[model samples]
Target: VKPTTPRGQLPLLKIDGKQYTQSLAMQRYAAKKAGFYPTDDIDALVCDECCDTLEEFLLKFPFAAKDEEEKKAKRAEFVKGPMTEISKFIEQKIQDAGGKGFVASGPSVADIMLMVNVKSVESGFMDYINTDFYTNYPGITAVTTAMKEHPKVKAYYDSLN
Candidate 1:
């Protein structure tokens, strides 16, 4: 998402702009640009659900206990089950939309959204998550593999340190 002049388009001139202040707003614009806007009201509801699910898990990640003995056994359960299930279900929906492996006839914002979402899980979900969850749903995975190879995405990921 571009931070812009007050007109919201330009050779962007705003420094310390609202766009710089709002990560959520930036991501929404990016998702929209990629064509991932929800298709219908129900899908919109689904999108919100998925977003909430991720935030809930993230809320606990920063404080996640460092050792098996350091954290209660149950403290980590909710994050894993719900987060993993939602991702798997969403992956199913992409397939159900069409098995050919795209959310629409061509690439859409949903592909990018899912790619980033799944990558977060790969980094955060400490348990042994087999990428096979994606294999059965190759459409979603294809987008992910391509995104991983993309120059910009690859650069951003490499800069994660």
Candidate 2:
């Protein structure tokens, strides 16, 4: 096999001999299979809220800063304030969604997606995850812990080492 930068094409997923390109499509399929998507109307709304926040953060903070002082300043200014507030907003949504649990009746694509970035921060990729970022949110912490222990997720993370 020829090697190339990560900019090269990603491997394809073929199902029933049909290929899917877009990641969202694949994620939706996985969500359906995983049964994490909401079954009720209101819960579905809540799920979208969770997904939206997770997606927003990825776009906002693409990676940890290599500039340590700058990262700390950014964390203190933007992250602890706006970013922390966003997390609380998501938590509030989850709390508002009644006893549905985890913004949905069960774990969905949103869970896995949020888990990816949260785990990155929790696993030492960021300096602030442990320092009050998720301090008040037990649900988020539990979710991240579960994601960290997930068999497949653990394997994928392990393979990176």
Candidate 3:
């Protein structure tokens, strides 16, 4: 699959003998096909923006930090600084959309991305980060909780374990 992908990425999607690359593009396509993507133009815009913003944050992280110690320091600084502001914005977006809504309408590609990133922090994927990252933000916690308890998500994770 990686060899067939244009960029040698793991998430290339093949359908009807056609291949689609880019994880975000595939995620969006899946969300749409699963009927989770918002139908309203503004809602779709919000979902897209949230998803892009979250992806950008992950991309901007100092994953290439020179040493383990430096990586830990960089991750800590990032979570305390820009990540704080991003969290605030996410909290606001959730509230603006209604407290229970994830991203635009409900569980969306944006929500899935957010949930996975949150889990990464919690699961020690980032050495210096922990589940406490979202402790101060109820809205973010709620979203992750919803995603975790979601039937399909839960079933997939259960299968993994």
Candidate 4:
């Protein structure tokens, strides 16, 4: 059953009976279908870049440390260093584009990606991490709030709850 996917990943998207691999690729396809993709070429590029950047950062942090002590230290360092830098850059990007709601016009795929990634840090899924993960990044929190208030986005999350 897993042989069809190029990378054998669980998040394979099946649309119209066709299978698609890679979370980012599926996200882009879904965003296009949902009219979340930006109309301008540069805007779309920025959206894609933001999503890819988050994915890369997530990949860099390995939660499976040798022990609890190491785990806590690693997570703390991640939040203080790379994570902070990335969040600041994203915040500035949103600000430079106008602090309405996203890295591009209104709420695009980039906004969704940003919200999801930021929420993961704040959600405390990792026992070692805490709410402090996102307290310093108001811009990211703003995006999360906007996405949460969006009609469809809210509905989807509500269904999960």
Lowest lDDT sum, 10 consecutive residues, model 3, at 98-107
Model 3 alpha-carbon drift over 4 Å, by segment:
1-4, 7-10
Colliding residue pairs in candidate 1: 34-109, 35-109, 36-109, 36-110, 101-139
- The residue ranges of model 2 lying beyond 4 angstroms of the native Cα positions read 1-12, 62-66, 98-100, 128-132, 146-161
Residue-level lDDT of model 4, residues 9-123, one tens digit each, is 5788777888778777778888988988988888888887777777777887767889989999998888778777877888887777777555546688888777777677667
- Candidate 2 similarity to native, TM-score: 0.69
Top candidate (lDDT): 3
Deviation from native of the Cα of residue 147 in model 3, angstroms: 1.1
- Residue 130, model 4: lDDT of 73
Task: Estimate, for each residue in 1-161, the C-alpha lDDT of model 2 and write its tens digit.
Answer: 11442334555456897655556656667777766567777766666667777778766763567787777776666675667777887666656644223564666557677677676666677664454466578767777777667776678789999
Q: lDDT tens string, model 3, 1-161?
A: 67767788777788999887788888888889877688988889999988988887787677878898888899888887778878888888888887665554567777877888888888888677766878888888888899899887788799998
- Residue 105 of model 1 has an lDDT of 46
lDDT accuracy of residue 11 in candidate 2: 54
Q: Which stretches of candidate 4 lie over 4 Å from their true place?
A: 4-9
Which one wins by TM-score: 1 or 3? 3
Cα RMSD, model 4: 1.9
Clashes of each: 5, 1, 0, 0
